[model samples]
Target: MTVRILVVDDSPFMRKSLQKMLEEAPDLKVVATARDGIDALEKLEEHKPDLVTLDIEMPRMDGLTCLRKIMATHPLPVLMVSSLTQEGAQATLDALSLGALDFIPKESSFATMSIMQIQQDLQEKVRRLAASPRFHPRPPAEPPAVRPARPAVPSVPISAVPIPAGTALPASPTAELLVIGSSTGGPKALQDILPALPADLPVPCLIVQHMPSTFTRPFADRLDGLCQVHVKEAEQGEPLKAGTVYIAPGGIHMLYGARGPKGCVELTPEPVSSLHRPSVDVLFQSVADHYRGQVLATILTGMGADGAKGMEQLKRKGAHTLAESEESCVVYGMPRAAVERGCVDLVAPLPDIAGHLRRHFRL
Candidate 1:
């Protein structure tokens, strides 16, 4: 199916470049180009495109403003085009919160990279998003009351008995660690799930959301602000703590080592063979090695099979696993792959995920 798109950017050169790249794939059709947020709104009405590729920094109305307007009225898939800068990362996250579906990060050295690679990445995102246009759970009309993310909770035991293939334990309420992986549609998916987690959640959660190094800090900060669970980018050698969500830094792998109730962070830059830097497989494998039967792993929306193998490792180690069902996933690749591998114990829709987690850990 051809995914109709409108490219919105203030830069003429970038707009044309993106257009040429997208046209390389027959499935992606650039229906119009908008110079800024104002132009984007006008073109949205005129073209009625299936999706929009929006640039965050634009004159005469920024991408965030345009995104708010679009999500309020038209509510189409909008992918933010962001730069790999601190400021760009923060604004792109703002776009996500305002209901942008996904994002593509641009580097300052974009001219130095191969356009072919960019074309493939861009087209793939467009194809996946247009194919699955279900809306994410929108935030409420009024903000939910802000409870502190970490309230004191009772300690729970960690099970050591291994769970066999095709088997799952009932919700233990004692799961000691929670790890999550996502890519294409993560930010919005997380928005739906994280805010609903109980303030006194007992597990320490680590996340590997496929994003640029520049983006992770701001993304974590944004989630921290909005979520009942405290969120932050993982720091090397920091001990794991309950009720906090640690996002893997963008360019480094977040591996766990010397496991216990108090596990220390282990970051690595080697083994750059994977498609993503803070690889889901790397993190999952590390957790499976140490946490074993005490773990609870979740695979959310993404475009690749990065987490499948590691999820398999976790499953083999008796960890309970959950995969987002296809109906709720924006791009169902990672979770589908894990499901195909027989690694997943439960298949739940996006909105039910928070409840599933709560019931599992009895938080």
Candidate 2:
């Protein structure tokens, strides 16, 4: 089936370039091109394309404003065209929280070293998003009268995990370390689950969310302000500590190493052949080797099979494992792989994951 798309950008060259590149795909077609958000909105009514590729910086109405308006009015899958700079990363994340499906980085040097890679990546994301049956638009948000509010994730209380009277608790909670991996739709999913964790969490949490180097620090800061548990980008040689969430920085692999008696973050550039630099498999395998059965691992919404092998190893070591159910996943690729590999112990919807964690760790 042909997936009709609307390409919105202020640059005439970019619009033409994107249009030409996208139409090269047999199943993809650019139905309309808009100069800016206003033109895009008008085109929306005229063409009603299956998807939209929106530029973040535009005149009259910016991409974020357009996104808010789109969610409020016509709601559909929107992919952001973002720069690879720090500011671009922040806006891309904001777009994701506001309901964009995914993003393709727009670099100034695109025509030089990365054109083919970008084209392939963009086309793939467009196809995957267009084919998803479970895409849900967020509740209508009016264009913010002021700066947008940080997502106010409701914290999960200890009482929320109901234990029936006389029910035997595990002799000991199975995990001492918590590791999570995701991609595609991870930021919003992590926002939902991480904030629910109490400040007194007994285990240190490690996360690998496929992202660029410019984005990881901002993403961690964004989560830090909203979550009770402290969140920060993982640093080289930083000792692991309970009650903190350490996000693996992009562009490098995060592994575990013993610094005297404590486990510390070890950033490396080895395994240069991995599909992703900060690969979920790398981190999960490190944890499986170091902590073994004393780990709680989860694979959330994503678009690849990166975490499956590592999760399988974790399961063999008796680690407790969970996956976000298909109904709650935006892409369901990573978790589905783990489940199919016979690694996942439980599959629950996104909202219930934190509760399950709390119950397992007896938080």
Candidate 3:
């Protein structure tokens, strides 16, 4: 099926470039382009495109405002295009919370961007969003966003289920550390899970969220304001402390090591060549080596399989692992990959994850 798209950006050049990039995918067709939010809505009603690539900064209504209005009124998958600056990062995170599905950052000049990365990312995201059953179907007048929510993964019952044959469920450890990794739909997913965790959570939590260099700090700020647990972007050589959540800063890999006998975070100097700098695999591998059997790793909703190998390593080392179930995932790629590799001990929905953590940690 042909995937219809709407390009919404204030710049005519950007709109054309984006259109050109997207249309390069044989299955994708950019049906319309808008100069801003108001124009976007007009085109939205006219074209009823399968997906929208929305720019954050625009003339009248901004992307965040438009996102809220769209989610409240139209209810379709909207991916945001944002600058990679500090402000851009915050707005992108805001857009995500307001129901934008995902985002890609544009650097100083949109034209100077590495087209190859943008092209690949654009094609992939458009195709994935289009494949969803929620995209526009035959009935033109029918609403797109009025679909029912998927059932979350059921909570871990009082009496745990038997372990599947080959993998041994680690004897429930008095979990000392919790490591989390997410991307794409991560901000909202993290919001759903993090705030609900008790302020006195027994272990320190480490997170590797895929974001741009300037975005992680603002993201942490937002999470800190909302969550009971103190959330901050992780820093180099900082000692790991309980009851606080450390978000791996963007553009660097976060790993675990020790300062003398005290366990501390190692923020590396240079960015790795991996697709993601704050790679989940880097963090998870560190946990596998340092925490071994004393850790609990949670893989949340994201676009790629980054955390899968890391989760596998954690699982093999007897760490308890959880993957968010598909019904509760905005993008099930990461969790699905972990489950496929037999890394998770349980698969829970977004809502039940916190409770599951409490139960496992005996909170």
lDDT by residue (242-305, candidate 2, tens digit) is 8999999999999877563448898999899999989999999988787633788899998989
lDDT of each: 0.85, 0.87, 0.82
**Residue lDDT tens for model 1, 119-156:** 78888888888766365443447967999789789999
Model 2 Cα displacement at 196 (Å)? 0.9
TM-score of each: 0.86, 0.88, 0.87
Which residue pairs overlap in candidate 1's backbone? 173-361
What's the TM for model 1?
A: 0.86
lDDT of 1: 0.85
Q: Cα deviation of 74 in candidate 1 (Å)?
A: 2.1
How does candidate 2 fare on TM-score?
A: 0.88
Ranking by TM-score: 2, 3, 1
Highest TM-score, which number? 2
- Give the best candidate by lDDT: 2
- Write the residue-wise lDDT of candidate 3 on 143-181 in tens digits: 677678888987785854332342222446667888999
Q: Total backbone clashes of model 2? A: 0
